[model samples]
Target: MLVHENLARLLQSYLSAGLRSWVQINVRSTNQFTYSEFTQLLPNPTITLSFKINPLPGICLLEISHNVAFAIVERVFGGPGSDAQPQRELTEIELGIIQRVVRDTFGPMKEAWRNVAEIDPSIEAVETNPVFIQTGGPTEVVAAITLAVEIGEHLGHMTYAYPYSTVEPVLSRLSPQSWLADAKHMSPSEEDSLRRAVQGAPLPLTTLLGKTRIRLGEFLALGVGDLVRLNTRVGSELPVFVGNKLVFHGKPGVVGDRMAVQITRRGT
Candidate 1:
């Protein structure tokens, strides 16, 4: 039960605040910790981040499943589908991306620790390895990112080993207490104002008729019957350029016989 609660908190940390999406963690294997192994009963692929405090040689592993990893990567890449398989083996580029993500997710916690404990936490990437496990008699593979945190040379070579289960209690103790416990206590006025702002945001008015060019002599000779060719192909969504930047891609339309455009997608 403690393991489940810790896993729940870990999942919440990743889903709500870390990756900002719903995710699940399934622990598929374990060596010594039974409470830690309970997470393997879940149905998601697990990722374990192992951390070692200097001189200990021992490590603490934070395990999360593969499904969660793919979900996180997809979210960061602004892609769809959480089940997409990562191509090839883990490369340095992929490891770097994962490191940045971990840093981003844990930056606040690290900052909080720095402020309170005055301990300078150093995170180092030791390895990004793949582990295979059998779940319900089915084989599953997961990619694990290992990081080492050196708290101090002393604590005398002591390995502060904490599973997701053990660390969860520590996390709970550190969680902030909210005075506004009810939704009713929150400011509805701010919500209404934000909604209004979103609704009132101005729509792009600029339109693109596609690329055009005119020679000096041609421009001088231009008259009412002069025809200018635009580079855009027919039936193609025109790119609306605003402030010389492509902002919207849309199909030309007509509103009450006046030329208009139905925006299809926004371009950043």
Candidate 2:
């Protein structure tokens, strides 16, 4: 339960950012089903995404409703999001496009479970019809998480199913302590990586000399060599900026053959 709730929060925020839209997610139901039963559980024409979680024995499954999947596809293609269902199997071209969203369904799992264990989940396959995939034993039980996703005026559901045997070993690790630890501390490697990324980033540096205002006719009638008046004194200090924000003050001067600003003071 803790795992599911945490996953929901991360998934909602991450997906909303990626899709550039408002998205709401909620846990609709939690239950268990036998492997054979689960395979046939979703409606026909559903998009089935399979993933392999490292250190786990079997592949996990994600079932998305036809309406919801189609709505997402339409939204990606610049259409107003639709709740209409798709009546036929997706073609190769459409599948290529939708595959990105399919792969991202479990993209948040690794981060959500990082404190408990560093797990890697890779896409195993995407099946338009569940009947085409070969899965586990008929009697194996799988835990299922049904979630309702709301986008605009449309509401749809997506389900994530994990084999009971595969996740049973790490069930004890999904606790409040793990979540708190993740929130309280950034690992040493993570901190170092963040620092390096900041250090490597490039910032645009520029110096604003002065500003002036003139009438439309005066501007239009100006010649190429004509000098325009500025609102600053000849020897006054000018403001230096880095990516829009004023960072320091400098004096205008010449460096060999080029014009320059010599830094005189820092910005408050």
Candidate 3:
């Protein structure tokens, strides 16, 4: 389910936003299997998408049933009533097309996650093979994408398995700790107020203040009572900013033997 959930999220991001609502993804099961061995286990009529990620077993797989495959192909090639049906058997050309489409869709999703997770984005497509599956009486055709995610440590390394039904559980398990831990992380009013507050805040003045400058000649010319003209003006309320925006204004004051800002005005 974890893999399925990941795939669904990935699919949602890969496909057009308008198409997201029309598609459904489910996780069937998840297990650990070797890339070569997994491919051998696939039924005759299958579609595989292959890509590589170095420093680990450079493979991952996305398998889909025939019904799903037809649906996807129909969508990609336009809609139903189109001439997308394979003649008698699935061809390598058809498999290649499926692979390209899947690769195009998933490549950006992988990159997006990589950026968010701070991982490398060096995966390359190797191949996409289609095979046929049979369960009982010709249930439907199936396709799979076998991707190389990383270089394998061993000659016959095992890869993670995420069949289509376990997406929700996996996503639940990987949900952000802070969000999961806090029941009331943000109230509606608090979130709305924060949005409004950020919108109304004044722009940062740090750049206007400019950088400090001091030359060796000037240093030698320094004397007692010599004033250093700072960008800040005397008696002017100092701005307190975070992330380059004014949050508060105050005058300098002594508090408990420490210099502190005494609030003179509050930022919006």
Candidate 4:
């Protein structure tokens, strides 16, 4: 129990800080099963993240329950993380959102395992289906750690499966003693962390003024300040985007010295 509790406390600190939410993690059960048995235990439509520890030989897995995934999605979109647990798998957009969080969620493993061995946990892939995942031979031992994940009023589960080959080298020093809370009062990372997580990423603001087709002769003959009619009507709203996503429509304007766009409406 102490072992589980210590690891839980460690993860609680990391997740709370990264997500900026009150998250409680308690290890529900721990086991060592054969790889074949491990496959049987996975939920089909789960968040299966494949990762590897530097200096270790095999890929490892961490499966998150759907409830937790959906809750994270809702919270990131400016809603309370508590939502009705759905029976279906996550959508493409939902998967992308969780993938970002998962990347952040696992990066701290290297810190937690520093005493055991200097290792790095790098997420290799995220999949909803586990059909093609392979961590080790069918008969190899797999250590599984299942935790009860809670955020607000919603509750779910997360299971981590580490193959023997991956953790064997560090087994001697892997102990709950190494994972005790660094701070007695570890608080959630800055207020509204989810909002800041997304806001910090750089976004390109590209404007599409108009479109037109020109023949070889016409395009070749174009000169500076030449007038060319466009498909769009004058004074029409221009489309502003980030990559392929249309974020908004705006009208062109100028302020003292800089040309700018005044958003007319949000994109659909």
Q: Which candidate ranks first by lDDT, i.e. highest? A: 2
- Candidate 2, poorest ten consecutive residues by summed lDDT: 193-202
The TM-score values for the models, in the order shown, are: 0.33, 0.63, 0.39, 0.61
lDDT of 4 at 237: 95
Model 2, residue pairs in steric clash: none
Worst 10 residues of 1 by lDDT: 150-159
**Most accurate candidate by TM-score:** 2
What is candidate 3's lDDT per residue for 61-138, written digit by digit as tens?
A: 455444445545555566652334443444566555566666566554453333112223232442334332211122
Least lDDT summed over 10 consecutive residues: which range in candidate 4?
A: 189-198
RMSD of candidates 1 onward, in order: 18.3, 14.2, 21.5, 20.5
lDDT by residue for model 1 (1-268), tens: 2222233334344545554554433222223433234334433333434453232222344443343444555566666543446644445565556556655545433422321122223344323342332111122222222222111110101111244432333444333232122224436753443344335433456887788888999989989988889898888998877667888899998899799888899976
- Cα error of candidate 2 at position 81, Å: 1.4
Query: What is the C-alpha local distance difference test score of candidate 2?
Result: 0.75
lDDT of 4 by residue, 115-191 (tens): 45567677888887777775678899988889899976779888888888887786654654432332233335422
Error of 2 at 261 (Å): 58
**Model 2: residue 183 alpha-carbon error in angstroms:** 8.9
In candidate 4, position 13 carries an lDDT of: 78
Q: What's the lDDT for all of these models?
A: 0.43, 0.75, 0.43, 0.74
Which residue runs does candidate 2 get wrong by more than 4 Å? Answer: 83-86, 175-268
